[model samples]
Target: MQDIIGRIGMRKAALGVLALAGATILAALAYEHIGGYVPCELCYRQRWAYYIGIPAALVAALFVRSRPALAAGALAVVGMAFLLNTGLGIHHAGVEWGWWPGPAGCSGGVQVSTDTGALIESLRNGQTVRCDEPAFRFLGLSFAGWNAVISLGLAVLAGLGLQRFARRHLAAV
Candidate 1:
């Protein structure tokens, strides 16, 4: 896998990263909109990396040939974003597994209202999703766990591609 990644040029690698990030975000949106899976606060937060990475990958791809340094920088940023996202995924997964508690807002809670009207309104607007619970799990891994795996893979790919670009272009400069 490392050899294959090392061999893929900067532009191709950037495109690959873009494709993967796009597909993952699209899948998450589909799960939420089409499949009726409501995302908790953390689930929504986990998407930040993909949102940032997609454009960065595109920029990297576009500038790869014209300005290799700029492309390398963009790819490095994408790699770092994915790496941070991987940590977030792992934290969310741990929360789901009861290894640690989730945030106060996302973990399970009800707002106290003394007024009858306020109570009714609060009930109507209450949060339905809890970050501590896994909405779905497959192969002993929840969505968060799968996200961690995918994010780590993306980070590694970006890193490998950056390394290759540096060797081929930066080293020559």
Candidate 2:
């Protein structure tokens, strides 16, 4: 582990992690843009973590020279992203199962006015977040379901990478 960390160092590893994180973001974008998939509220929530992780990795790589320390920062960011995605996935799945309510802002606000014209306008605007709907699926898994699996795996990778750095740089392993 230590040998790997010393060899790759902070900058390279951080760059690599950031690159992977970017790839995931791009993939999600493609799913929405090219694949014509829409994101649910939970999907957007998952994106928040990626946003955080990307900056964390890039900044740590750029300014932080110490490999182990920088890796820790990067891992924390990515790991948080992963955990958040996992939670979103679970929550979305629950929503699909009618377990709870999703955020009103993205899902749908309470219909305040009962005017027929206003109702028609809202319908025409196509303003719905449809938390029950799964926008895309991979191997029969919805985006949220797949996110749960992939994000957990990514978290493991980040942890291993960080552990390698710590063991090599600090533990003399």
Candidate 3:
């Protein structure tokens, strides 16, 4: 098994990372498109972490298969991704609880006195997505809430994978 995996090389690792990334993206898309969830500004910011993570993981996979790089990259990607998500969760929670004002442009709680026409246009375009609103839910929490929990789990798993397979990988290659 070890020999087979060794032969498979970084290509396999890249695919695995990509697979995880793809799954994450698909889940988000499903939630938004199929499930009819509208994402907020912070939610989009969290998604940007995914965008960076997937490619960085791919490049890290393409490296000389160093365990440290591979494992560290895996951990970093997940960590960074989760970090962004964590912020989003806190912000969303604040929005839900009204702890602080959300982004001025969106959040619906923001104040603007430009004109009735501009206000109407902004409302019509949905210019700013709000954090307070619960667009969709899987259990009881909103998607941002769910992302906070799930990303934490994924980060831990990535760390474990680095600790486990990473050593053998470094020795083999």
Candidate 4:
């Protein structure tokens, strides 16, 4: 692990991880636009991690050469994003597997409003996508399941980046 870190350098690895997040986001968009898969509210929520991680990765990579402490902080944020995404992905997968219910808004539960006109408007503009249903599966894994797997991997990579930064900082000290 140390050899790999030394060979690649944390900055490059951070950039690579950021690119992976961006590519995954693009793939999600493609699945929605080109493959005609409509995203549920949970699906949209799952993307927040990647959206945040990409920018954090950029900052980490940029500052790693001159300001490693700052880079470490940014990498920590990236790790947290992926870690949070992993939990969310697991929850979404469980929802699809009937292990638990998703958010009321996306799980097909009807929300009653005191105002009839507001209720009527919500009904007209409400989301039709169901978070409990998997739009498609590959190798028996839903997209949420895949996201959990990928997010766990990203978390590990971020950990490695953090370790690298720590080692360098300690050595300098």
Candidate 5:
């Protein structure tokens, strides 16, 4: 495993990051649209890193041969993004598990409005998705838990790719 990881060049590493990030986002979308999982505010927020990292990874892959330093920088940035995302995932999972409180807006609670008009309006607006609840889970892990695991993996991959790229290309400079 170490030899295989060491052998992977910057371009391959970036491409691997791109592929994984893209697939993860696609699966999230599929879960929402096809699997009938309605995402909470935190769930939407969790996707931002993937949205940014995917393009960055692609650019890094494209430039790895011609501009190795720039590619390495992009990979570094992508790694940081994934690292932050991993934190967010953990926070969200904690919220779902009742380990910590989530944001007031999306956390589970019903606000009572004595005004009949406001109550009717809220009912018309449909249900509010709660961040403290998991829309789906497999085995013992919720979507947020799985996301934490995946984001950490991506971050490590990006770091490894950057390290390999730098050792191979930057050392010559």
Candidate 6:
């Protein structure tokens, strides 16, 4: 299995990474659009990684054929995206766990504006989505928790690709 995967090379691995990121985004959209899961601000923020990772991975795949160094650099970008996502996931999960407060704009108790007109306007605009609560939990993990797990896995894969690429480059030199 390891030999087969190695033979498949970095391009295919990059494609797989991109595919996973795309599928994950698609599933999140489905959950929001089809399953009626409204996303909070933090949820939306968590998606930035995928938004960046998918295209980056595609570019990496494209360059992998003729420009191995460029492909490796792109993989590094993908890895950074996932690493940033992992940090966000951990922070969000901590928020959910009540380890600390979330952002003032999105989480915590209700706020009443000082001015009467502003208060009325705030009420008219509707409630703000809180970051500290999960819309739903699956298998004892929130969406943020799941994202952490998945993003970490992607980061590891990218790291492995980096390692493999470096080893090959070193051997040739």
lDDT of 1 by residue, 4-49 (tens): 8678877877898999989999999999999989999999999999
Q: Considering TM-score, where higher is better, how would the candidates rank from best to worst? A: 1, 5, 6, 4, 2, 3
lDDT of 3 at 155: 49
Candidate 3 clashing pairs? none
How far residue 71's Cα lies from its native spot in candidate 2, in Å, is: 4.5
Model 5 lDDT tens row, 1-173: 98987887778878988899999999999999998999999999999999899999988999987887788889988999999999999999999999999988789566678999998999898878999999888888899999999999999889888878777777889
Q: Which residue pairs clash in candidate 4? A: none
Q: Rate the local accuracy (lDDT) of all candidates.
A: 0.90, 0.71, 0.65, 0.87, 0.90, 0.85
Worst 10 residues of 5 by lDDT: 104-113
lDDT of 3 by residue, 47-131 (tens): 8766776776666565635555654665567556756666777677667666777776567867785899988886787656677
Please provide the root mean square deviation of candidate 3 (C-alpha atoms, Å): 5.2
Model 4 has an lDDT value of 0.87
| Candidate 1 residue pairs in clash (backbone atoms < 3 Å) | none
Q: Name the weakest run of 10 consecutive residues (lDDT summed) in model 6.
A: 4-13
Residue-level lDDT of model 4, residues 28-121, one tens digit each, is: 9999999999999999998999988889989999998798888888888988999999999999999999999888877878567899998788
- Give the CA lDDT, 0 to 100, for residue 32 in model 4: 99
Give the Cα-based TM-score of candidate 1 against the true structure: 0.92
- Candidate 6, residues 1-173: lDDT per residue as tens digits? 67754654567768878888888999999999999888888889999999888888888889986999999999989989999999999899888878888887887765667999998888898778788888888898889889998899788777777777877886889
- The global Cα lDDT (0 to 1) of model 6 is 0.85
Question: What is residue 168's positional error in candidate 5, in angstroms?
Answer: 3.1
Lowest-sum lDDT 10-residue window in model 4: 1-10
Candidate 4, residue 111: the lDDT equals 64
CA-only RMSD, every prediction: 1.8, 3.8, 5.2, 2.2, 1.7, 1.9
- On lDDT, who's better, 2 or 6? 6
